[model samples]
Target: MGDGRANNPNSHSNNSSSNKPEWLEQYDVIGKIGEGTYGLVFLAKVKSNRSKPIAIKKFKQSKDGDGVSPTAIREIMLLREISHENVVKLANVHINHADMSLYLAFDYAEHDLYEIIRHHRDKVNQAINPYTVKSLLWQLLNGLNYLHSNWIVHRDLKPSNILVMGDGEEQGVVKIADFGLARIYQAPLKPLSENGVVVTIWYRAPELLLGAKHYTSAVDMWAVGCIFAELLTLKPLFQGQEVKGTPNPFQLDQLDKIFKVLGHPTQEKWPMLVNLPHWQSDLQHIQGHKYETAGLHSVVHLSHKNPAYELLSQMLEYDPRKRLTAAQALEHDYFRMEPLPGCNALVPPQPGEKVVNYPTRPVDTSTDIVGTISLQPSQPVSSGNSVSGGNPGRNGWRNKSWQHSDAARCCTASSSTAADKKERIRNGDDWIPSTTEIEALLSFLI
Candidate 1:
């Protein structure tokens, strides 16, 4: 945890890149997934389980001080103990001796919410199906509720951090990942860090960016509002121009952007705005002018942006005291009146229960495809293309042939080992279905 006082003037910024550590030789690299200021994520397979694929995040250790950033280490430790369907599961962490690097293993998701929005921007603009939007929002709120119930505050709540498991039908199984900036809020005692500039710029709550020393879960609620607006318009709601030198915002300029589209808040509606730590002093100067004409055009620039525009305005209110809580937001008229489809779908049945209402399958599994094994009622299957005919009741999930393509086989040949299999399976590589198989599975689930 940070000690409240800023670190030494010479401490390295978290954004700088460092040398790759040597201990990375244990696994064979497949490809790169994404890169950020602190680390690089690689698509890798454990040597023991040639069929399994995992995403490994390799972090650069400090040379003279603590090896891994304390914030990064704290996130890993916290996530390791949390097990939720909506939260990203942390598989394992290892310290590489070669260059003293820290590697974290996690489930590899197909794409994040950001990619989905970017890809479907046109579709969303034409007319977003209320059901689909409701489903996504419900999952996002559920994930946030789980985190808050566990006392975890996801300081950074942006689209990029919310990952989707399957395509379309299986779409709403959102997993909240990237806990490097998350922290547990303890009361009565002062927080370890006072630097409120934590979340991504656009999703940042007004209080934090203005240097509020103490905050609560409401900060995250504010971010959720930003995300909700983004989902509606297929564009970011509070994105402001980035300042060059200072990390903090000098004025509430982004709030002005939001008000321009939604209309200025009146004292009667937002009585608490004047009490905010960073309330604007020049409100009278722009009070009578049409906010939209004052260089504050909406990104979509739609003429009929009514209900969505109104709801987004309320969510992005500058006053944290007036912002909607997760539970309250869940009950808003937008979600209540026109709820998204599949928001109330039956939760997946527990082990041993029959899947009675299964959706239609695209491809018949009765006929086996090359390199793919036919699933049996019950059996213990190995990674090899071949399957063992074990007792029907031995292990319920055994009959499924763990498929491995030539690409996976080649990567596994070099690092095959029992330890590697255990590590890879624990990290979620074993659960990834082949792309062809995933399409078929989507047909059954969507």
Candidate 2:
């Protein structure tokens, strides 16, 4: 059934019998916004209502000769049942009859948290306002709480999966987007670990890192803790590199980074830690080593130690049982602090500061609606999970850095001198010379 679709891209015309589904004909393709391992996301506007733009994700065919990808089916099934203001809304679904490709339409978001954070760090040259951070966190938790209460684990909750409305009724609202890795977690089912790996390497929970067979909502809390810390510092709290391979579950280096900051975990601290598969073998190397007693306060530099710090610490607790739930976190004193969390993440600049507006997501008009990046006879289009390898765009561990006393960058205040770039590297800033820098250096030599 999968191989039955027509090879020609132009076969899906309006008058043809093998044309687009009735549901799909309504949207006018704007351009390509993002490309994932399994699908291509398009920014489109509905013909009926041209006022609002929407994001249409077109899923590729199954690799195993199946009619449709199981991952796509799971995403469709779960998203159909779930609905929330803080969650990305699924507007409609359609299947291209010509190729049997599936498309899911969602409300459009102009900016994602990943882009937002990067804009502030590299472009704006300022940290995101605390007010904006609080609002984004509150909304994320609000949506996450809904998913947890419904017994669904999103599994993936990085900044890219978090979308913010551009304008209109939902303008400035943070919506939890992307549910490709999401699954309905119930009492009787296969262990989550059996269903391939979940969550990005950097935002992954400690239990998952230790090779826990079964986990709970606490895994999500651990990720939230990481995200919260990143929001504060504009950097990943535990920026660990992914260990790539087949059947290699233990990421020792990632765990090492965690231990370096939070210290070692003991059975007395987390009773379940001793029961994990990797705990025994992994513990051998770190048993004798002494670790600094660094807490959330050390990594996240805030003005004072208050309820916000307390909440951040509790959310990142090693013991899953001891971690704060999304619901509990909402009630924390951090939220109760003066100047309550607002509904919109776009906080106005204070007096004497100019307003900052971010650039919109870039769209490549060259890519057609069929989402065929390349259709060479020699190279077949592979149908794997849309998950990307290594860091992508301006997001992930490599893009952001640990600033302050930890890692200094001499390039910021200093001139664009070769000495400054060299000093930046010597000062512990792991910045590679960009393409522009290389071009400039070559021109100087000429």
TM-score of each: 0.61, 0.77
* Candidate 2 lDDT, 365-425, residue by residue in tens: 8876744422222222443234444434557766566554545455444445777768878
Q: What digit string (tens of lDDT, one per residue) describes model 1 on residues 1-446? A: 11111121111122135222222334455666666877667766556665355677767556686767876777887887788877887776755333345668876565666866665574333434445556667777777888887788888889989876643444447788888888888652445245435787678776665556677777888787778767667878867765545645544566555566556656676575555455554445434445543222255343334555455555666567777666666666666554333532223323452222222212233322111211111222222223434456666665544554565675577467756876887898676656978778888765
Clashing residue pairs found in predicted model 2? 37-386, 38-386
Give me the runs in candidate 1 sitting further than 4 Å from their true place.
Answer: 1-28, 46-50, 122-128, 167-172, 188-193, 265-272, 280-314, 332-446
Q: What C-alpha lDDT do the candidate models reach, one value each?
A: 0.60, 0.78
Q: Provide the RMSD of all predictions against the true structure, rounded to 1 decimal.
A: 21.3, 25.4
Q: Please report, as a residue range, the 10-residue window in candidate 1 with the lowest summed lDDT.
A: 368-377
